[model samples]
Target chain A: MPAPAPIDPRGPRFNQAVLSVALLTGFLVDWRPVVPLFALVLLAGAALGPKYGPFLVFYAKVIRPRLAPPAEMEDPRPPRFAAAVGVVFLTAGALAFAAGHAGLGWALALMVAALAGLSAATGICVGCEIYLVLARRRPVAG
Target chain B: MFMARGVIVIVILFAIALAGRLYRAWRARLQDEKPIHPLVPDSLRAGADRTWVVFTSPYCATCGPVEASLRASDPGARVVKVDATREPHLAESFSIRSAPTVLLADVEGNVTARLVGAQAVDDYVRRPPSGVAG
Candidate 1:
């Protein structure tokens, strides 16, 4: 049989995000050792976006099909869209850090931070068009 | 013995769901395998702890509240999110095909529970101890 098509890597972004959210939650709950670890991963995902982005794409499109045979018309737009959203988070994080809004920055970072976790719990991505409707648009007027 | 067992069918079904979650918890338990340059790790376990392994995707909407409920209750079980996008292998390893998947594990590499669909936190509330292997 012909090889099955690739699963969308963007799909797992939600899961990965959810995982991180949970880990951060633990940090929040415990507030001692894990915050740094969470920060490291958060920072890394940002710095290494290009590297990991493609990997996530491949995983979502090609790899996911093996175990979870995707729907015929699975949304192919999430990874592309999530890249845009990642920028939003990184920008917010940067601004917060720059303006000395550590608390605000953390909160903002946490908002975008929920991406992968949201993905993991479901196939619906925060970056997809549907999310564009559910989530409020940014007020920056960009 | 048979009569006693037959009397608790609801409890038994609940037990089955909990049993299936064991592997999910294990897969979630799998730490994000190491990455040399701190980019996204190839394995789903990258940069994650054992407590959280959620098999969800970018499109799934139902998982949100379920996750919130779980975190609200335990406050420490940290839910590791795995985008079927990033680590499909990890999801396969745990035998999860559905979105909004959840795996409840401990820090010691043991998966005690898993839920495949959107489940309420009450689904996992105040139940008997889970039955995952060491």
Candidate 2:
């Protein structure tokens, strides 16, 4: 496969910030629907591309215009993979909530929120790091 | 009820963050020069004057590249690959929770350096085993 296109490093941080806040709000409000809705958003970004992601597109069109360009761009694949991870956790959390397991649902959602918050605050994306490790498995020339 | 749930959420968030921090610290500890106590059996231990025993699991994506890189860096060096998943006891004995953990040992089976994770592959390649021609 061809290399993934690069994106503004700030865009992912923006997405992470929104995701963290949304997830925490969902948990605090005991709004079960919020988890799955955000999961769908993440799924769209993972399955399609940054252009299809509401948060990323919003960043590109609105937030990005207000700020100067980043000094370096980053590969989009890692963040896309991170979106897929978020989808998995949120989907599972929604399922748990649907099954009346509030504790499990909250645990899953909170885990994702914590990770997203860390990425947003410290720029240390655990899911992206996992993606990079997996990406390195691709056959390299001897 | 909502207030209680809010507290639960905050607690869970803190728990996750604490777990992450603890994991990083543990990994760092494993990277220190901790010898392989109660030396491994002859079948699994280093067979040469200097060897790099790479503990890997089947699920580890970077294991193959890490092994390949080590071999490429030193054609004559002894590189042993042990599947941690298959050998759970061995992995447990060495306190190996992660794959691609490279342990450098001398002829006596005494570990000199402990490198873990994909990042360690570059580190080992940069500074190979001492007193042995790379």
Quote the chain B TM-score of every prediction. 0.53, 0.73
lDDT of 1 by residue, A1-142 (tens): 2212233444445436543454345425433233334444444444454235444545555656665543223333334455456556656655666776666555545455455444444434556644434322321110
**What are the runs in model 1 whose C-alpha is more than 4 Å off?**
A1-10, A14-19, A22-68, A130-142, B1-134
Candidate that scores best on DockQ: 2
Residue B40's lDDT within candidate 1 is 25
For the predicted complex of model 1, DockQ is 0.03
DockQ of each: 0.03, 0.11
Against the reference, the lDDT scores of all candidates come to 0.49, 0.77
TM for candidate 1 is 0.33
Error of 1 at A22 (Å): 8.2
lDDT of 2 at A27: 77
- Residue-level lDDT tens digits of model 2 in A1-142: 5445557879988988898888888878878787899998888888899888899899999999999977545667778888899999999999999899988987888888988888876677899878756644552121
Root mean square deviation (Cα) for candidate 2: 7.4
The best candidate by TM-score is 2
Q: Native contacts recovered, in order, as a fraction for each?
A: 0.04, 0.18
Candidate with top lDDT is 2
Off by over 4 Å in 2: A1-18, A27-33, A44-142, B1-13, B20-33, B44-47, B129-132
